[model samples]
Target: MKSLSVKLFCLLLVVLLTTPAVAEIVVEPEDITWTTDAGIVTFQIRFHNPDPTAWADEVSCTLYAQDFGVFLPNQNEIGTYDVPPIPPDSFFDVFMEIPFDQLPPPPEVHHPWDPMKVQPYCTPDDHWDGNVDLIWAGPGGAGTIDSHLGTLLVCPTYGASEIHVVTNCVINMTYTITGVCAGFTVQLVNEDYTAAPSPLAANWSGYIRVTADATVPIGTVCCFTVNFTCGGSTIPLILCAEACDCGPISNEDLDWGRVKSLYK
Candidate 1:
C-alpha cells in the first residue's frame, strides 16, 4: 500500500509541473465622448482591463464608420491608436481627431417629394452606427475584442426642434446636433417675424441661440424651424417656441469655478 501511494503522488506532481498557468484577461469599454467643429469630428474613448495579474504589452483600437448605401464604399477606418504597456486592472483613454478631408462628402439626394429619397435612407440601415476593434497583447498571448459603439449620426445633421416656453420672455435655448461631419451653419427660418439673432456656426460646443420677441405678448407660442446646412445638404428642424422662463441650461454652460471646488 505505501509503494502504491508513493507512485500516485509522483504522477500528480509531474502533471501539475507540466501544466501551464492560464492568465485571466479582459478588456472593456468604459466611456466614449465625441465633439465636432469646422466639419471635423473628434472621438475620445476610455478603456480598461479587469485582470489583476496579467499586463498587456500593447493595446490598439480601430474605428469604423457605417454609412448607408447612399455613400459609396462605406465602412471606412476613421482613426487608430496604439499605446504602451498597460498595467493590469488599469484604465487608458485614447483620442483621435478626424480631419475634414478624410470624411466622406454629403451625398446628393432627390428632393423629399421624389421616391428616390427612400433609397438613401434604406440601405445602410444605421447611418451613424460604428464599430471598434480592440487588440491587446500580453506576455502570454494576444487577443482581440469588438464592440458596437452605437449610433454616431454623422451625415445630414438634424435635431428634434420641439421646445416649450412662456411667451414674450427672452428665454435662452440650446440644442445638441449630432453626426455633423462637415462645417455647417445654424439659422432660424420662417419664424413668423420672431426676433432672433443671426445663424451661428456649429462648433465644438453644440449651442444655438434663440430669442423670443418680447412684444409678441404673453401666453403665446410660435412654431418655427431651424435649418442646419452642411455639405450641400440642409436639415430643417421643426421647433415650437412658447413663453416661459426655463432658465439657461446647456452642456457647454459649465461652471468652472464650481468644478475647481471639487478638486480642491
Candidate 2:
C-alpha cells in the first residue's frame, strides 16, 4: 500500500510539473511605424518575447491591405525572417523594407496638388491607393492574435508619380476609375471609345482596357480619364501617370526614431 501511494504521488507531481502553461506572448506597440527617405519605407516592428525557450528558425511575415471587413482586401507578401530563439521575457526588433518605386505606396502619403490637402487618397498612386488598410502576419506567435501588427505611416515621402519606367516588350493596359480610384475593371476602347480586339491593358487600381487609338509609347505616361458609374451617375476620375518596368525593389522609408515601433 505504501509503495503504491508513493508511486501515485510521484505520477501526480510529474503531471503537474510537466503540463504546459500558456503565457500570452505580447507584441508591443501594436502598430507598425514608418519613415521615408528617397522612396522606401522601412517598417520597424518591436516585440516582447515572453517565452524563454521559444525561438524561430524561420518566420514568414506578410503585409496586407484591407477594406471595411477584416477579410484581406489587398495583400503584399513582404518576406520572411530567420529569427533565432528569443530568451524568455526579452524584447527584440524586426524590420522589413518596402521601396516607394516598387510596391504600391501607402495612401496616406501626401501629394503636393491634392486639393483636400489631405494625403493622396491613395499613395504611390501607382495603384488603387484608397480604402486600403495594412496587416502583418508571421510565425513564432505570428498568426496568433497577439502576433499580428497594424501599421500607420508616421512620416512618408510623396511624389512617386514623377519616377520613370522603361519596358522592352509590348504591354497590356488595364483601367478603372472610381471616386478616387477603386475596384479593378478592364475595358479596351478606341479614341472614340470603342473596344478594340487584342488590346493591351495595365493591371492597376483594378484592370481596365485603355483607349486603343492613343499611340502611347513604352516610357510615355498613358493617362486614363475615366468615369465611375456605380451606385449613381458617372463619377469622374483621373490617373495622372503610369510607367512600366521601373526598377528593382527598394525601401525608401527606413528611418528609425528614438522610440520603438510595434504591432497592435
Candidate 3:
C-alpha cells in the first residue's frame, strides 16, 4: 500500500510537471484608497499567469470592510470579467472598481496611515477584507484555482505626498484600451490637460459603462474594459452593467483624465 501511494504520488507529480502551468490565476493586490463617496472605489491589482502557455480566465471580486463586513447591493458582489489570454511567464494589471451604490459608505473614521509616508486622506479609512478569486478557463474549461487571501488595507495612500485638486500635467501615463465586449468605445479625457507643467501627483483613475445589442436576463451582468499603462505597469479598468428589466443595456457617463498618448 505504501509503495502504491508512492507510485501515485510520482504519477501525479509527473503529470503536473508535464502539463502547462495555466491552471491557476494569481493576483497580487496593491493597497489603494479613495477620498470621495461620489464614485466607485478602484483597486490597483496585479495579475500573473503562472502557466507555461497562454491563458485567459473569468475573474470576479467581493469587497467587505474590516469594521463593517457588509453586503453589497444586487446580490452582494461586484463585476465579472473575462481577461484576454496572457502569454507565458508574463503578467498584466487591472483596476477593479466597485461602485459606491453597491458598497457600504466608508466608515467615518478620523485616522489613516501606511508604512510608507503618512499623508492625506487621513480622514478616509476603510478595509478590503474581502477577496479576488480567479479560476482558469481556457478554450473549454480546466480544473484549478488561484485565490488571493483577504486584502486587509485601511485607508493607506501607499505613500502619496501632494493633493491634486486641479489638473496640470497631461502626458505622464500611457493608455491602452482593451475591448472586453463589442460595440462600445472608450477614451481618456482630462478637461484641464495642457502643455504647461503643474504639480503634485495621482495615478490611473476612471469610470466606464457598457452598451450592447444582446439582451441578457435580469439579475445577469455584462462587462467591458479599457486599460492604461503608467510607470511600466498595464492596468485594465473593467466596467459592468446590471440587468434591471432583462433588456439590452445602455451606456453611462464615462469621464477620464487626459493623458499624453495611447498605445495598444
Candidate 4:
C-alpha cells in the first residue's frame, strides 16, 4: 500500500508570459525540485502592485521548464495559475504545479519506455530552468519584463518503492484492495515456520511485496494503498525498507496501543 500522504496530492501544466510595465510579478520560494516523485509540486506565485492609489486586478500567471537538456525531455510549459487581486503597494499570492505524466521523453526512447512518464531520468545533474510571468491589469497599468521561472531541479534518479511484510506468527493473514491501485501489481509472500513443522505450526510469517515493472519510468514513484487483515485484533508489526520503499511502519507514523496483556 502507498502512503496516505501521496494519495492526497492534486494539481499540473501550461505557461503564460505577460509583462507588467507598471505593475510587477513576483514569485517566492525558488529553487524547487522537479518533485515528480511526490506526484505534483505546487508553488506560490505572488503579484506585486507598486502604485499606492490603484489596485492590480484580473491577474494571470504561468511557469514552465526551459529545457531538460540532451537525452532528457524538453517541455515548454510546466503549469499556470491565476493570481488574486493585489491591493496597491501590496502583493497577492497564487499557485503553479509541476505536472506528472504530461512530459514526453526524447524520440529515441519513445516506445513503451521513453515518454512513458514525466520524470526525466537522463543526467544526475539535470537542472530544468525556465521563464515565469505574472501579469495583471490595474488602474496603474501593465508592462513587460523577462523573468526567471522557478528552477526545476530534475535530478536524474533510479530505484523503486516497495512495501514489505515483517510480521510473523499471524495465521491466515490476508489483504484486500481498499483503494484505486491502477497501473501496479502486488505480491503476497508466506514464510514457513522454521522453528516448528508446517502442519504443527498454527501461525507463521509473511509479507506483501510491490515491485515496479521495468516499463515504469526510472525514478518514478508508484501510487496505491491496501489494507491487511490478519484476523481478530493484534498490534501492528514494524516495517522497514530503503528510501521510498514501503514496508515497516515508522514509529512516528504508527499509533501504538495495547492489544492484549499477559498476566501471571
Candidate 5:
C-alpha cells in the first residue's frame, strides 16, 4: 500500500508539471469619438488587448442606449464586426453610423394641451453604452473575454446650415437643434445677433436673420450660433453663410491661380 501511494503521487506531480499555463486575456477601450450631422450619428471606437501572449479574434460589439427606440427604428440598434486577429499587445478600431430620420415621430401630447407651453420634440440627451467580446484561442484552449466600452454622451443631431446671400443681402436663415435636454436655452450668436427662442427647450428649431448691416463686401463670411443651455451645461454651435449660399469670390470658390500666387 505505501509503494502504490508513492507511485500515484509521482504521477500526479508529473501531470501538473507538464500542463501549459493559460494566457491572461484583457480587453479595454482605447478611444471613442462621435459626430452627429444631417440627422445621423457616427461613432468610432478603438479597442485594445493588453495580454502580451494572447491574440484576439472573432470580435464583436453591441451598442445600447435607453433612448435608442426613440431615435432609431426597430432592429436598427445592433452592430457586429469580425475583427482581424490582433497580435499580442495590440489594438483595433471599428466604426458605426446610425440614422435618426428612420425613427418614428414623437407621440402626441395628451390631456389639456396648452399652446402656451413648450414641448419636447425628441428623446433627451443620454448616455450610450456598448459591449465588446472577443475570442483568444491559444495555449490551454479557446477562451473569451467580454468588456464594457463605458458610457458616452449621445448628443442630438444638429443639421448643416449655410448663410445665403445675393451680392449684399442676408437671407433669413433657419436651423434645427434636436436632442437637447429640457429647459435648455438655445442661443445663437454671430456677426449677426445673439438670440434665443422665447422659451427654449430640447428639440427646438427656429430661424434667425443677420442683424448686422447686410451690405458687406462680396465673399464675406457670415457665421451664426446656436447655444443650448440646461442647468449648467451648454452646447454652442456655429453655422457659416457659405453653407447656404455662395458669395462673390466665396472663400471656397478661390481659383487655383489665386492659390498658386500665395505660394509664390
Candidate 6:
C-alpha cells in the first residue's frame, strides 16, 4: 500500500494545488490489511508524524469507514479516537476492525467454487453490487510537504486559513480482505473497470480473498474492481473506499452506535 498512498498523494497535489493554506497529511499503507476468522475480521493501521512542526499539537485522531453511494453499512465511519500530544519524530499505530456480517451481503453471493456464478458480471451478466470507502483523520489539516517515497515524517508546510479548502493528501493505507476460501483468484478493478490482481490469499469459486496495496491520501475517492475466477473464466465485482476525516462519534457521520454495537 506504500506505493498506492504515494500515487494518490501526487494526484491530490495536482488536483488541489489551487487550494490555499493546506497542511500536508501523509498516510502510510494506502490500503488496510484484513484477516477473517469465521465471521470476524480484524486489522491495524500504522501511522507516524514525520514532521515535528506539523503534528506537534495534533491532540486527536479519528478513523472512519466512508460511505460509497450504496446504503451498505461498510461505508460508515466505524471508529474515532483521541490521543495525547505525540513527541516529535515519532510514530503511532491505530487498530481497527470490519465485520463482514455487520454490513449487508452483496446483492448476490457466489460460492468461490461455483463456476456458474463466476461469470455473472461479463457481457449479459452485469451485476450492480455496491462498494464502500475507508479513511482516517488526525490533528493536521489537509495538506502535505514533499518527502521521500516511504519516509515517516510529514512536515507541516502551511496553516489553516479562512479558506474552506479541501486538500487531499496522500498517506499509506493497507488492508487484508480475509475470511474468503483459500486458493481462489482476487483482482481489484478501479472505477474505470480496469482490473488488477489482489494480494490476498484464497481459492477459486469458493469465496473472495484479496489484499490491495495502493498509495492513497486523504480526501480522494477510490473505486475497486474485485474479481474471482473459479472455472478458468473471471467474475467481476466492484467496491469503493474513500479517504477522509473520521473524527469523534459526535461528528455526525453515518452512525456511531451501529459501529460500536458490532464490537460488543
Q: Which predicted model would earn the best lDDT? A: 1
Alpha-carbon TM-score of each model against the true structure: 0.35, 0.37, 0.30, 0.30, 0.31, 0.33
Which scores higher on TM-score, 1 or 3?
1
RMSD of model 3 against the true structure: 17.6
Candidate 1, residues 1-264, lDDT tens digits: the string is 999999999999999988754443345433555555665677676666566765655555566543211112235577776756656777667787876446443222111111222234322211222333445455534565433322211112122121111111122333333432123222332223232433422321122223433343333444444343434544333332333322232333322111111100
**Predicted structure with the largest TM-score when compared to the true one:** 2
Candidate 6 lDDT tens digits, 1-264: 999999999999987875533233345434343444555545454445566544443434444442122112334444554434445566556666656556433232211122222123211212122232334345553321111000000101110001000111122212233233222223333322234234322321112223222233433433434333333433233333223222222322322211111111
Candidate 5 TM-score, C-alpha based: 0.31
Candidate 4, residues 1-264, lDDT tens digits: the string is 355545443211111223333444443333222333344545455556666755566545455443221111224565655566667688765556655344432111011111212223232212222333333333434532223221111112222222222323336544443332333454444443122222222343333344443344434433333333445632222111111212233443222321110100
Backbone clash tally for model 2?
33
- For model 6, give the 10-residue run with minimal summed lDDT: 146-155
lDDT of 6: 0.32
Q: Quantify all predictions' global Cα lDDT against the true fold.
A: 0.38, 0.35, 0.35, 0.34, 0.35, 0.32
lDDT of 3 at 116: 22
Off by over 4 Å in 5: 1-32, 68-76, 102-264
lDDT of 3 by residue, 1-264 (tens): 999999999999999888764444565433223322345566554556677765645444333332121111122444444555566767666555676555433222111122122222122223332323333344424432221211111221111111111111233654444644343333333323222222123432222222333333333443434444445544443333333221221222011112111110
Worst 10 residues of 1 by lDDT: 255-264
> What ranges in model 4 sit over 4 Å off?
1-37, 68-75, 101-264
Model 4 lDDT at residue 22:
43
- Model 2 stretches with alpha carbons more than 4 Å out: 18-22, 28-31, 50-60, 65-72, 108-264
> What RMSD does each model have against the real structure?
18.5, 16.6, 17.6, 23.6, 17.1, 22.8
Which is the winner by TM-score between candidate 1 and candidate 4?
Answer: 1
Tens-digit lDDT track of model 5 for 56-156? 55444554322211111133343555555566787777787766443222211111111112113212222232233334344323444332221111111
Looking at model 4, report the run of 10 residues with the lowest lDDT sum: 106-115
Model 4, TM vs. native: 0.30
